[model samples]
Target: MHERMIIAGFGGQGVIMAGKLLCIAAMNENKYVSHIPSYGAEMRGGTANCSVVISDKEIGSPTVPKPTIAVVMNTPSLTKFEPMVKPGGLLIYNSSLIDQKPKRTDITVVDVKANDISEAEGSTRAANMAAIGKVLALKPEIASLESVIKALDVAISARNRKHNDINIKVLKAAFAQK
Candidate 1:
């Protein structure tokens, strides 16, 4: 299986972290993976995004010109990446921040109230994790929820380990959605 994903949002939205978590989880599952992150000079609040590729075979390039899955956490990101998703691909957008709906009819679109769910779970910063969880739930072939939880242990640093429990909770909460 091959999955090309683009995760995007404002810099502080954990877009890079979500990509890292997906790579780490895919790696733990013994899959070939690649990740490339991009962000503006201003960092937090500025635009941020990452391309992640997971496959059973070797990857030709790290860049994702047209992604099979696009997870957008904000309106700007939605505007930028929505048209870039391949036909028949999946688009997951955070409804809490984006009021506009996707225009494409060929691809599947799913909306998650990531910020609201994360806030309800205790931390709004974990909205990225929530979004990832939804992705995993919708496309379990890419990576399992267990692998992603384990990835948190590896992706999150020792100093920030305190947030692991909350992040895990958010992940599970989102994954449980129907």
Candidate 2:
């Protein structure tokens, strides 16, 4: 059950952190996983993305040239990674931020209003968790909700641990919404 995923968004949206959470969850579930992060020069508004590979067997490489799933949180990311999704793959975009829909018909496309939902929850940053939740819901075999919670504990730092509840709330909300 190999799954290659690309999580992308502006630098401040926690794209890399989301990939790290996925990798941590996969590892906790005893699955082989890899995470590779790439970001532009500027920190806040620059492009940020990560390639994650999860599988039952050993992974050969971390690079994901064509991902099986693409989660884009911004319009630029949607424009950039939409074509990178492999044929028959899945594309999940934050509809609140990306105005344009995916043009591809071969692959499955899901519009997740992550930003709006997160904002409604009082934490706009939780949109990343919402997007991750959407992915886990669509592919239950990838990781369990318990694993995700545990990963959140490990991924977040001591200073930022206070927001864990909000993050979990947003995750469950997104999962339940679909």
Candidate 3:
């Protein structure tokens, strides 16, 4: 089955990096994938969004009008993309940044306290990693948990070890909560 995912948040939150990592992992799995990132004024606080499409067939267009999954790190991003996700899709919310809940009943919503999970793991910036973990766990196209950790270990640089580890923990914890 085809899956479309969107990760949106403020700049420096690794929103784009997370999307790229998914693309990397999907490609590693030998699946057809495409990652499109939004830039410019939206990169700040306005709205930074990145889309990842994974499927068995050739992806005709990267732009998605209806995503199968969405990871929103802020309220505005959540509100912006909430309606775009299709019925029976998935939406992972960074509860640390958003206070409101999704009102729709069609999609499965997973609220992750990603920031706290990252903080407890010893880094504040790793929240994005944590969110990524949750997304990977819930998405079938993503690698297994062990594979994901292994990928991250090899993918993360020496300087980013701390961030990488914490995010993996966040992903594990989020999965457990589900």
Clashes of each: 0, 0, 0
Clashes by residue pair, model 1: none
- lDDT top scorer: 1
On lDDT, the stronger of 1 and 3 is: 1
Off by over 4 Å in 2: 39-46
Better of 1 and 2 by lDDT: 1
Q: What is the lDDT of candidate 1?
A: 0.93
Among all windows of 10 consecutive residues in model 1, the one with the lowest summed lDDT is 38-47
Candidate 3 stretches greater than 4 Å from native? 41-45, 153-162
Q: What is the C-alpha lDDT of each candidate?
A: 0.93, 0.89, 0.80
lDDT of 2 at 126: 91
lDDT of 1 by residue, 15-58 (tens): 99899999999998999999998745523544689999999999
Worst 10 residues of 2 by lDDT: 38-47
- The C-alpha TM-scores of every prediction are 0.95, 0.95, 0.88
Q: Pick the candidate with the highest TM-score.
A: 1
- Selected candidate, larger lDDT, 2 vs 3: 2
Ranking by TM-score: 1, 2, 3
